[model samples]
Target chain A: MEIPTQKKIEMLETMLLSRKFSDSLVELCKIQGKIPGMMILSTGQEAVGSGVCAALEPGDVIITNHRSHNHLLSKGADPKELMAEIFCKKTGCNKGKSGTLHLAVPEVNAPCTTTVVGGTLPIAVGRAFAQQYREESAITVCFFGDGAANEGSFHEALNLAALWQLPVIFLCENNLYAGAQRYEEHTRVIDLAKRAGAYGMPGVIVDGNDVQAVYAAARDARQRALEGGGPTLIECKTYRCRGHGETDPQHYQPRDEIKQWQEKCPIPRLSDELVSSRVISSEELKGMESRAEKIVEDAIRFAEESPYPEPHEALEDVYV
Target chain B: MQKLGMGQAVNQALREEMHRDPNVFIAGEGVGVSIHVNPMFPTTGLLEEFGPGRVKDTPVSEAAIAGLAVGAAEAGLRPVVEIMFNPFFTLASDMIVNHAAKLRYLSGGKSSFPLVVRIKSGAGFGAGCQHSHNLEAWAAHCPGLKVVMPSTSADAKGMLKSAIRDDNPVIFIEHMGLYFAPMPVPEEEYLTPLGKADIKRQGSDLTVVTWSGMLGPAMSAAQKLSQEGIEAEIVDLRTLTPLDKETILSSVKKTGRLIVMHEATRTGGFAGEIAAVVMEEGFSYLKAPLRRVTGPDIPVPASPPLERFYIPGEEDLIKAAKEIV
Candidate 1:
């Protein structure tokens, strides 16, 4: 089922605005050095996080893969908390203990997010499993790259999820790479969704850069899971366009390939659709940009002023 | 009361806890996979009762399993994670030490991590170095972790029930050899609180303190020595972290001599820590310097004959006990 053209544009704009915010984080890494060991740039894969996160109710749980940040902000973690986390400030979501990699916000039910590949899948499955055991209607939405699908836990967890019909939406952002390695280099078959058939489940592949398409697919998958339709594998075909991590210079990717994907940037396309359909005037989109600029500006100040955690505090939060 | 092995005792404890508390859930590999290794005929039917949701079998992600348990506990679920191979505890130490142990304290005592990590440690059954490691001393070294090892079915049931109930992270280790060691455990609801030690055997001339699988050998040694008119008091330090210094020191005072025994190798073993405590606090009560009888400092050998040499036996305990007295 296709989402209406108008609603599609709105969702796509939200994705566009979020991508603008995260792109600022990347630029600030050069402007202010807020980046750390490995900054997982959301770059071209913004639609998956924005789309899946938009469809979820505030109380609904969402867990993201290592290539996160958009998932955090889209799910509504404090902008300051996310910025402070990337900057290693005590005011961050995990009190600076989680860093840019591992983060969580329990109040909104983003209890934890991990930097380890394929690590957050079982946790999302467990969170949903626990919610189901308690008879709550909250469905867990797990976001992972296509690379995570190749992990053994991916196979085991999805198989278990389908067998048990757990309330979870496995959102696969098929950005087509495991760091420097292309997705095709790892998996035996290119279409990752085809593998879901082995688990007796439906697999949907979509253009990840199309925010509304991603959103509609997420809403349908999550609804089915919450209503006991079991698990569905939705592969959002996207690109890593930039490097995998900040340290990932992406030398393996050819310049022409990067140029082509950059030309398909989701924000410009969405902004174009919004203006052409008269969903919003160009002035209105520009106003959203100015507002986002103010938010990011304030976020940067908060990150700069927040004090670093004491060395002793590093020894803390090991358990709770 | 029913006669049960250590494995059944643990299973019963888990069942009783889950039945009593809606928040309690047990997870790990092979827990629901026909209880792998044909480890027991008794725990075979538990999967049918609890189902995979509660008694989950994981995909060998030890770190993720422990970390997931931490998050679940934070979200208000009491998770008892079973680590299939005891030595694999090394993989989960980050969550266990950094997250589970320190989380409450770091959170200004606002949050409690009611997570119990169950591991079957120690060498036996020809499973050499990688599979076997007595982690009592290592776990004891951590401030936030509460370590427990039960040699008998009764203690296994009672202590596990206690560990599961305690509002803290606990590393409940089990010696593999004691899995089949049966004892009459209560069928009714019960719990043996942690930080309490039991005087397994009474004596006057010398005191022998031990735990885990060593409890058996130490007791046997004490019993065998009674014939020689050398009365030896045997105390089992069940909880390793909060060592029962009162029991250990009191026993050492009465006997005026102490001999510590452990399956872990001599240096840095749980016995060394106990010996140091006695030397520091119970020095005046000692008629002779404290002595330790432990496995030699070496990787656990696989050969039955060589393993017999590596692990401390009843003969070794008897000899050490006689020498100290």
Candidate 2:
């Protein structure tokens, strides 16, 4: 599908920025051992996070899983603060308490992930219920993997959201494989969107690699939610170029599958389009990539120079 | 003067609180109606009076119910959640641990988790292992949760009322053994503070620290000891979290011997904490070493014969009292 000029230009910029950031994180992983073990990268799925978050307001709440660094960045979290959190510096989003996957910045209304599978969905339902109770038109969007659909909490939350008519958008980033297991192997129901249909809400499937597509689906669902149209389920079919985390060998993914998705690399597809459309040239695209590299370097420098927290600081945020 | 059980006292408290606060309401698995009726039956006639929205029967999803209550409590409503059994608490732990307990602290003390979770506990009446467990220690260990276990009819009524009005997450643990047990309770507006102990009997020989169903047997043991001229002080700790250390310490000082008792397993029970407190505060006054007469370390068996020996009763209390003094 031919995308619009403005959409393509912005798309390439955001996706390339995500790719650059994650790539730099792997390098940081090499130098400082920052990411504890395996770090899941939205290298290919960056388009989905960037596009959906772009349509959200500051008041709207978004929650997701441990694979959530891109979501926070797209939701307007300061990169330096995010880097500080990962580095365990005092300047971090959770004051250095939370790392890459569990970042919560109150300013953007994006909270930390629950870390466990299928945890955030029910919590999102509660938040939406709270919003509705206050008679506010705010909508809550929950991001989870297709594996989460198999969890009871996923069903409980969706059922409650539908029953209460709570404003929540269940965004399933179906990256084809939940770790090593492919989606079709475990789930009898091939389509997760159809699971939403079982709850009496519309389930839409979209090209998660396409920023315009993800944004269109997200914005429409958000409007429907804000208008008290209950909950909608959007299954974004994407791919995980990176393993579950930085630690995974990614031996489970087939070579052909990886090659196929790499060809549709969200960053390059839109970048080439922006370059050809004259919205941006190949030189500017290269310049932007270099700029992203330097930005990441500065973040690393800031994080490395920042002092580690006091030992007692461990107990400070345990409750709060 | 009125004589009623703690469960009746709780029913009285509900009747009174519903009259007092329009925002106060009860909801849970069977608060309104059930196929087998509520085993706890704490919400009889409440659904009719308050409507399903207030005194509603939720689906068999404790997490959703608790989450719904947390949402309501956050948005200016007082909700009382009835978890049918203490074992069922696992389903609501997310709401309890993640949200309700941490909301006040997370919001920088700006908000209050004004939610009450009433759970049925104790293992004396043959409810099987899962249905019968005294898990109050879990709540006592939590930072923001206020754990209250009332032993008398009056205290149950007063404490439940206090819990409904208090701006904190309160777990009102009701002992199944004492639901029908009778005591004198006033039919008037009253509130027992969240963290205070009541001295059941005056004595000079020994101090008995206990709560929940154990309080009755402790009082009976104290009375029997009193008849023999060996005075035993009975201190009932109505609340477990902000434990009534002051009352416990004073009673220990007066009697010079402390014996803590509870129906929960002894390994990590709340009564163990009381023994620690007595040792910390009244170490010099002890006539003998502090002792804890508690349930053994085993899952509550379903057999009533084995269960009787498991839960501390009058005989167990008498044996402990005589052993100390």
Candidate 3:
């Protein structure tokens, strides 16, 4: 479960980059008249994405949900194309058809993203089924929010995945709130990981903000899957700092609770860890932040310069 | 040539296609282990031949089944999924319409979805409203889906091969009533291409355009009409989406009259689409207004007598053809 110093530093860099990218989107929405489509920011839950994705190989497939910018970036999706997608430009990953809610980069082995809650779980099971059938030593990862655990598809997908012993890691990023509804308010089971037991799969819980904790759990779960040990549900106990979307108001969440969670921000915590462990100096950590900010700025410029797709292009990709 | 039932023809097609392509596989609820030791009709001997890996038996989770098929298709497998009946297709519509149909387009052509969904449809055997509905119109309305319904054994085999080979998602509708119905099928390999209509019977008086279960009643009516010297041309529209407008227009132009028919309710059946096409393109050639012989807008009742009244029969088609002519 021990991650090398270089890998830990890369994980920190990815987490920082995701945070900067998410913050930039919020800023851009304020300046622009509107964010192209629905935008769900994964601001506070970077460790889960960075940790789980870092554990995966290039051939591994990951299915993501609406709050997918972090997952895509952690999985090595191009920031420029993703930004172009957010702007609905023709140069986007999905040719401007799928906005923020549905961005996919097949080049990174992340083939699909869905806005529907719990939608990607079954598809992930399917990808794993294909991998198992082909006898390929690749695993499939599915990322979803707390709300998705209540969906019937989650139960079905887990059952099938476990029954077939398919190579799949069901990563539940429990971000405490599902579109303003608190996790406990929606589901009686506070621990989403425990639900995996019903399907006879190992259920592990991790401190989602702690990068090493999330990374260790993900590494173990992925290893078990790749070793023909069936699926595992690893619930990362996390929180979302911002409102659900750009239009959502801050009426639902308590201000003090938000402050408490923000105080434990993953980027700063990981940065502090990296510095204290002597993995890197404080100046090096500062340099990574600036580099991440520069990447986000360049991506915004690329997206702004890209042209909108012609109206006729909408009719082109429906077939083939 | 061999005489085979529609179900046997379908089974033959699946076996041949699986043998032909390594990526092709079948999955559904009762596919791997039939209640009886003997294999079921359409999936006969599939488990024994391919083993449980390819002939997968799944839980009664239609949504997951559909999503699994879509994902597997995207990941380089040609998956043929079977929904026990057509009405159950409603459970999987989200996956079919949103994911399977839209994947290729949403990916900007980076992905190709080659998935086939087979569902048995139509009213017969007192299966009740839940299991007896023919909802091909719903699938045809979706832009990214191809809808196909084959009536004969040969067409059952041929169209399925074509559907499996198709690069897009195909909704393959099989008629429960026609599953055991015997028909002639060739032993040689063939494919009934998508977007093409077949002329079941050629005549010059009036064109009877129909598909699936309705083809039987229409043919019966066409036979009865022939006794009275009315030669009705029967045009079987095998594929609903990417519809065979050329054959429909040409037939209507030659016959100067058109009667569109389907087993589904008249409210929003694909007959309206065919009627509109003829009205728009072959308006001047039509000697009479386009007519539709379809089931009433009520659900298929469970009682035999009521069901008989509910389903459109040969008499209805004959009456409609006589009135139109």
Query: Model-by-model lDDT, in order?
Result: 0.78, 0.78, 0.89
Model 1 chain A worst lDDT run, 10 consecutive residues: A8-17
Interface DockQ per candidate: 0.15, 0.21, 0.77
Tens-digit lDDT track of model 2 for B162-279: 9998888888999877877778898667788889988888889988888888887888787787788778888888898877778888888888988888989999888778878877
**What tier of docking accuracy does candidate 3 attain?**
medium
Summarize candidate 3's per-residue lDDT along B211-272 as a digit string, tens digits.
Answer: 99888888888889999999999999988998989999999999999998888999988889
Name the runs in model 3 displaced over 4 angstroms. B36-40
Encode model 3's per-residue lDDT on A66-94: one tens digit a residue: 99999999999999999999988999999
For every model in order, the TM-score on chain A comes to 0.94, 0.93, 0.98
Residues A42-137 of candidate 2: C-alpha lDDT, one tens digit per residue: 878997888788778778888777788778777777778778877767766666555665666656766535566777776687667667756776
Clashing pairs in 2: A38-A245, A38-A246, A38-A247, A39-A245, A39-A246
If both were scored by DockQ, which would come out higher, candidate 1 or candidate 3?
3
Worst 10 residues of 2 chain B by lDDT: B103-112
- Candidate 1: give the clashing pairs: A318-B98, A318-B99, A319-B98, A319-B99, A319-B100, A319-B103, A320-B103, A320-B104
lDDT tens digits, residue span A1-320, model 1:
75666555456555655676677767777754555656677887777787787788887888776776778777877777778877878777667766677666666677666655776676666667776777888788878887788776576668767776878888888887887888778888878889889988989998888787788888999899888898888999998887877667788998998889888877777778778879788898888777777777788799889998888886664433
Give the share of true interchain contacts found in each model: 0.13, 0.15, 0.66
